[model samples]
Target: MLADGTIGEEELRYLADLYAAEVRTSDDAIGSFLDGLAERGLLDSSIVAFLSDHGEAIGEHGWIGHGIFHEEILAVPLLIRFPGGEWAGRYSEPVEHIDLAPTLLDRLGIPIPEGMQGASLLPLLRGEPAALAPDRMRVSQRAHGIGLSFADAPGLRIYFRRTPSGPDHLEVFDLGADPSEEHNLAADPASRETWMPRLERYLEWTRSRVAEDRAFRVKGSGIQEEDKGMLRALGYLGEEE
Candidate 1:
């Protein structure tokens, strides 16, 4: 569907239908699993969470895929059903994937390690206000090559590119005013004085984390031809693979 630059109405409808079908299938499978568990008297003792790493951009912002610092890709669905569904309500505040482990540990009565960067969301889950620190920021990154990352601050989001050639590039957006990210505020003089320093600090911290992660990384060879063929068949890898 994303082969061509242009996306027709038929493509859009097909994408929507495909997404709907996947959702229905997933729900049915989960429901069946839960029914079995209930029959075994174990349904009321589990915490289920449904989330996605990123969202797809069919044609938003003239883009057909994710890995961009756009709301269409960043804002994903997160549904958490606790053991009893108590305190079940919508939370409008921003949360990140890093918080999941800490939240789960906190809920399980386990202590969160000091080395973890994420704060627990247990208070919010209990219907209380769980405010993030003033300086706390959410960061998202690309997974391949000289990776790109973005720091999401209050009302502002700064995207930093860690390219191998030339100088690094930055793109800033005022999400409060333009949630669609239609405007670029990086060039605005007023935004620089406020956001640049924060971006620099966050970037330094992120670089350190990346370095530490690399220190413990394990190298792997390229996948086997059979595995590559299977990935291609599943529409995960490109046809060229």
Candidate 2:
């Protein structure tokens, strides 16, 4: 699965088969659960939907963990079945994790407040194009605290992430051409003319949208002048006093 040739395809298939068995059982259970709710008069007016925040990586690109913005980690399975006739089906579209909230709100005819980044799922559900093109970019960053187990260097690095580059990317990729992401086109000179504007706009828009928790700063910091002086003695802060 990592393409290291250490593990055979047969082994991967076996694991996949095991997971598939579980999926079958789960799907059946969900159907039964829905049926039970229906019998209890709880399903007639309900809009049933199931969604995973992100997908799991089954050893793609030498990676086992999730959180990197790869398609394998971001493009999750989505299922939406309307209450009434003929709308039960699958939608093949590039939906983002952020879109989930907006979709539910729109379905209930509720007004989604401004600065919400996601779009409604209605267009996709109605068999319309959700735009197979890479419309939005997803980025993720992780940082460890100072004075922690790991040394403090302010770690920041972008990875190419995965093969068959889709919507999500830890770095950037041209989804139309380098879908597999075999090529490191992020630094390519030619891409500047094409993707730079979109990239800048997306970044700006992301910056404009604020999370309430993030907007508020921690007022009660334990690090006082003496603590800062001690940290500086240990070379934590710079020459600035």
Candidate 3:
């Protein structure tokens, strides 16, 4: 913007150009790989999946990276093509990366391991009726902030950010009405009262998962029996006392 209220575009955008170039390179590689599969008559027999681990923020919200709760960073495309192009369609429901493993396992006729946080999305993929997911919630969190989206409440997102020296800042957006998140419902006391209580179950679940992950980390830190000898020789392990 300038003094005349005109948007200026005189500067060169080298970073954005580089990002686009990288995306094109990836596209070329993927196209080549798929062509090879087709050349070998394996295209129809393949179950191809395309997805990104996270999104990027290029000069949006004054940030330029991932690992944050912004929708620009959290939203990523997931495209799965089954063998013979079965169950091909677009879906609008909320899903996470955790669901991919279970879906693959289910498709491969393998038993899903117990206690996985994600459920198989086979029903939805196949366009079959699915049971209501009362506990369906998408949560992204860090040490200082958390963002949440509930299945029952599509297009609604809530964010909580801990300030360095004050109360946690809360933001709620009804994306259906405020797609840009310009109006924060959290500023309203009535809206806050309604949404604040919903955080309890999500917080409880987060704590439990954190505890479980901690225990697993502790167990994993133990030296393996086969590696004990090498570790002992390398002074990384002590003799049993």
Candidate 4:
């Protein structure tokens, strides 16, 4: 609750309530738009999705915004409402934003590109046989930290962090037991033995993947200022950053 250095608890509550009000206002607008679409009989025929590229941290772990390694910031839902309510249930497996495009293409019966790094969720959505293999481990990153967690055990997570003035840091937590991450299990042999090997393998693979991406990346002039403002309006820079 003391995430802000300058604000007292009263001010913080006021700000949080303001934020919630804004969110509700936006939700109301979206609901009205959807109602209009339904009135026009277009809601059933169109593919609609609501998702976010990143999540916010209010006061969890004293973090005030996105770009931190925690479930609060990384586990936002990727909700897609398929046309005609074809897939109408919740999904509990781990998935990433990269998978969205392939899911869309698969849903539309288009061939996915060979080089795409994500798998489609269409089969899983429709409850088809031979569902995509569940991804066991998911890795996420921010400017200073890289985190890994297992799909099978959602509550266990580990983080590797770079410090500006010291050696890197590692954190291990059983979030089920310590949702606030108040205990550090990094030095425990049992915890290290269970998670270190997986971290090592993932790091090695990441090195190679980074190299490949760099080698194949195409250079462009970068975003213009006007485009950046437009992107901010459309919610994508507000996405990654």
Candidate 5:
């Protein structure tokens, strides 16, 4: 932006190139590993899964990390090949990491342990309707104090933030209108009426999830006052105005 005058196409192309290289390298490593497995005849018996925890933002909105809840990060590539089956196709459904445990157990006819998250991969293998359904909306929270959420249900909050400061930079985009999130509506008070209530509901849901995670144990909260500020900067503040 310093020399380019604005976040123009050239800057975006540069960032895309960087991420593309990472993807290529990742593909190479996976290819090599699969080759090794095939050499030992273990590829057939082995259920291969390729997954990434999250994605990086090369320069989207002047950000560089993976805190935003953009589809780029919330969504991941999942390829699973089971043993002894004609299941070799793409699954487009929005699956969660939590669903993995249950799916695997279901495939093997083994019981899934309690308190585990994730769905099963059997539907995809069987070419079920659920597997064809699009991914359900989801949220992504990172240690960087950035939080993001999405919903098919409208009036929901879909945005990202930087770490907190006095004048915290909150970037909330109406994904319904701006799917790319190229615009920042955080400082626009005129849009608050629609977003505030939705944001409140989102906050409640977030707090509930946090409670379930046992994050507020009070024994070793691990976060300090400044941490809250950081979260605020990242747009993770929970307290009300």
Candidate 6:
């Protein structure tokens, strides 16, 4: 869909239909597996979690894939089915992927690691109103130096795109008023003054964290001409790259 940089409505509709059908198929499979487990008395003591890493953009924001700061790509479904359906209720609070590990540990009565950044959602799952701190911020980033830096309290979102040899680009949006991110508030003096400092602090923290972790490094392996051609055909790598 992204190869020609144009996505027709009919194409989008077709993709949507295929997605729905796949979802139904997956649901049926899971249901059958769980039913078998229950019949064998195995599911009475199990916890099930259904989640996606991220959502697809479809035609939103002129994008079709993930790895963006847009709400369509950031928001994902998370359904936790506790044993015996205990404390089953809908939660509307915003949570990050990092919270999943801590939540599972907490449920299993294990202590969360001291260096973990996410809080456990056990309280929320137990019908308690577990609200995030007022100063809490959520961040999303891609390997291409694009970042979404935002604070829930201030309702401010900054889309930062860094170039290898050029000035970084920034687009700010007030998510409270414009969830679609249609307006750029970065040029406004007051908005910049209010949000820039927080963004800088977060960036500094990220840099320090990266410096402390030397276990993994990103290195590119030379791609063969055939692989490059295949990727280009798949609309992943552009000719300029």
Estimate every model's Cα lDDT from 0 to 1: 0.71, 0.57, 0.68, 0.69, 0.64, 0.73
Candidate 4 off by > 4 Å: 1-7, 128-155, 205-241
Error of 6 at 139 (Å): 5.6
C-alpha RMSD of candidate 2: 10.9
Tell me the tens digit of each residue's lDDT in model 1 across 17-91.
Answer: 887798799889878987897898776788787788888777776666665656777788887777877568998
**What order do candidates take by lDDT, descending?**
6, 1, 4, 3, 5, 2
User: What's the TM for model 4?
Assistant: 0.75
Clashing pairs in 3: none
The prediction achieving the highest TM-score against the true structure is: 6
Greater lDDT among 2 and 5 belongs to 5
Candidate 2 residues 1-241, lDDT tens each? 2657766778777767776797788799999989997898878678777777666556665555455455566667777666663477655555766777888898888998899877877777777765332344444422211110110111111243322234534344544455554555557676554555555565555456536524442234555877767756654443443
TM-score of every candidate relative to the true structure: 0.73, 0.59, 0.73, 0.75, 0.66, 0.77
Sorted by TM-score (best first), the order is: 6, 4, 1, 3, 5, 2
The TM-score measured for candidate 1 stands at 0.73
User: What is the Cα-based lDDT of residue 76 in candidate 4?
Assistant: 73
Clashes of 6: 0
For residue 91, model 5's alpha carbon misses the true position, in angstroms, by 2.0
What clash pairs does model 1 have? Answer: none
TM-score of 6: 0.77
Q: Is candidate 2 or candidate 4 better by TM-score?
A: 4
